[model samples]
Target: MERIRLTGAQATMLATLYGKAMDARSPNSVLHDTMALEAVRRIDHDFSKVGIKPGDASTVALRSLHFDGWTREFLAAHPEATVLHLGCGLDTRVFRVDPGPGVRWFDVDYPDVIDLRRKVFPEREGDYTLLATPVTPAGWLAQVPADRPVLVVAEGLTMYLREEAGRELFRAIVERFPSGQLVFDGFSKRGIKLQKVNKAVQVAGATLYWGVDGPAELESIHPALRCVSAVSAFDLDGFDRVRLAYRLLAKAARMIPVMRRMAIMYRLEF
Candidate 1:
């Protein structure tokens, strides 16, 4: 089979589908919930036309929802705060969160993704801008106003970065903005090792290169960095219709703690 350059929307579609596949039984799970699932279904249909198979499609979909939930929660409290979504892909978070009139939102990604996004979504005049540039390069920070409070979110992008680069990115955000918050998903060291053996991960072009054993690991990156919360699918609350087996597994993972090595979202305040 020939290799295809998957667009950001295509990758996001896969992440959403993966979440739906894993938690299809949980009515409260984002994948099992409302409009987001419908969006995922639409993306999956598009992926099918492009010859993307079900398994790969689902993995990306799950990852998208996982980050989407975290991003939505953070934006809820800081609606007025500026939101910088790194490696945003084609996720409709700005619409999902609906920052209203005052909040400033910037979606940063590679040029190709931005190009496609403009065509796919309507361009609103105020409160949003699509930035087409590599996030790692310097000078992009100047574009954002340092006066307002900021929240930087990195969803599925961190795992692809090396440890030093990730740390530098964290430091840069803290240094650039006077005060803000960050929420990003990270894998544990064991998770990194396991990915090497997981054929499923290999097929998706994913590798768990960055890992944080616990909150302290994130805090150690900078003294100003404070871990407000760490969450896993198992830690999520408010599910009325969870299955017995799944509930048991989630509870067991929390009790053991070691099971958190799989994947956890870290919320940091600076």
Candidate 2:
């Protein structure tokens, strides 16, 4: 089968799907996320089809669930705030969030992803808009309301970006919105090195370029940005319900911080 030509960021969405599917034994958002994973898994790419191993699949599911929990918590508290899902890929967060009457939602991604999203998801009728532009592009921010509080979600995205690009993107977001929150997952140096050796990651063209050793580093990039919560996959309480092997692995990872590294979410105010 001929392989599909997907950018590194685009491929990361596939990884998200694969991960979600692996953890579908529960009644959480993972069940909904599995839809996208199943869609991509059926595609004719060799790496997506055969190269993905059990471990890689587990990682994706865990990360997706973590993001889903964070998003739910954030949206529940700030019903009036606008949501900017950077690198939105094929996620159905709008449906999951089910924004109330006053809430605004925006899904931003590459043209191809946005175009594909249009076909996969329902049209946004009220305060939602789908913007087809790269996350780093200056023009995309113009479409969003500068005065409203915005919540930006960047999942499985920053790792592909060079450190400077990621920093600049964060700075631009904080400067663009007067008061908002930015939730993203970060890769540690050890996690990046692990990806280099992982066959599935190599075949997918995901090369980790940005790894913040600590969440405090984000504060230095922009003073307004506060490190409200720094969570690792191991720290999440949900892991206790997982299978024995997964729970054990999560426990061991916590013992050796570098084993799984950390993924964090931040709140930025200007």
Candidate 3:
């Protein structure tokens, strides 16, 4: 089995990877990412240390599914568009979305995380590239073709960066692409302040910094950027599939405006 030695926010990817793996193993798998399941088997780490319960598995898978759905929608319209998946970690989205040969897919992350990805995941064929670099203000953006429409997706990545860095990252993507969409999950300020109670944060000893109460906050990053859609976490596709306790939590989250904003998925068009 492959041993994991990642630390900080990078290390949190393992818990999500394992959560998706557990979801794939379940009878009512939300994302059905069998590749995630396989990756977990190849890794030597004891995932139990992360404390990913069945509810967490469902939550992770559901988030992935929502992002997958958005990607599918974009690809169906522009099959040849370039896909920029920032902070990719160990996610198998390239496999999950399975875009056409014309769609160039780039998975960006730190060098060590990319190295771990290469070890656990199989080599993908046709128009797929793994970029080993931090996404923020990096020259790595030069590697992506600027002509085609771009679909930028960042899952479980925001809030890790300071607000300035996060806004700059958003500014960079909107400025780089002529036309396309950016989809990501964001937490509210209260959520970031209350993050110490989060299991994954405890496991990885990670830090949270940026937070936005709404998509309007993201729009200020670039003049061309426009809010397309904003969906709360509990309102995602597989809400019913999650256990009742999680469903109740979602219902409760809905009542509190800040809590509702705490787990929002936003899509913006430029």
Q: Estimated TM-score per prediction? A: 0.76, 0.85, 0.97
Q: How accurate is candidate 1 locally (lDDT)?
A: 0.66
Between candidates 1 and 2, name the one with more favorable lDDT: 2
Model 1, residue 202: distance off in Å is 2.7
Q: Which candidate leads the pack in lDDT?
A: 3
Candidate 2 local lDDT, 1-270, one digit each (tens)? 223567565766655555555555345433455555454555555444534554445456656666777777776887778888888887766776677876788888988877766655557678889888888755668778876778888877787788898898888888888787888888776666667665555666767788777767888999888887778767765575556787888888889867656554444444
RMSD of each predicted structure = 4.8, 3.1, 1.0
lDDT scores for all predictions? Answer: 0.66, 0.70, 0.89
Question: By TM-score, how accurate is candidate 1?
Answer: 0.76
lDDT per residue for candidate 1 within 1-270, as digits (tens), equals 112355432244344433444344343443443443444444323433332343333334455555666666666776677889987766666765667676899999878767756655557667898889877754687898877778888876676667887888888888888888888888788777776655434545555577778899899989999998788746654322345655567677777777855778788999
Where does candidate 2 stray beyond 4 Å?
1-4, 25-34, 37-59, 260-270
Clashing pairs in model 1, backbone N/Cα/C closer than 3 A: 14-60, 14-61, 15-60, 15-61, 15-62, 16-61, 17-61, 18-58, 19-62
Give the TM-score comparing model 3 with the true structure, all chains together: 0.97
**Model 3 Cα lDDT, one tens digit per residue, 128-177:** 99999998765678788898999999999997988998888888777888
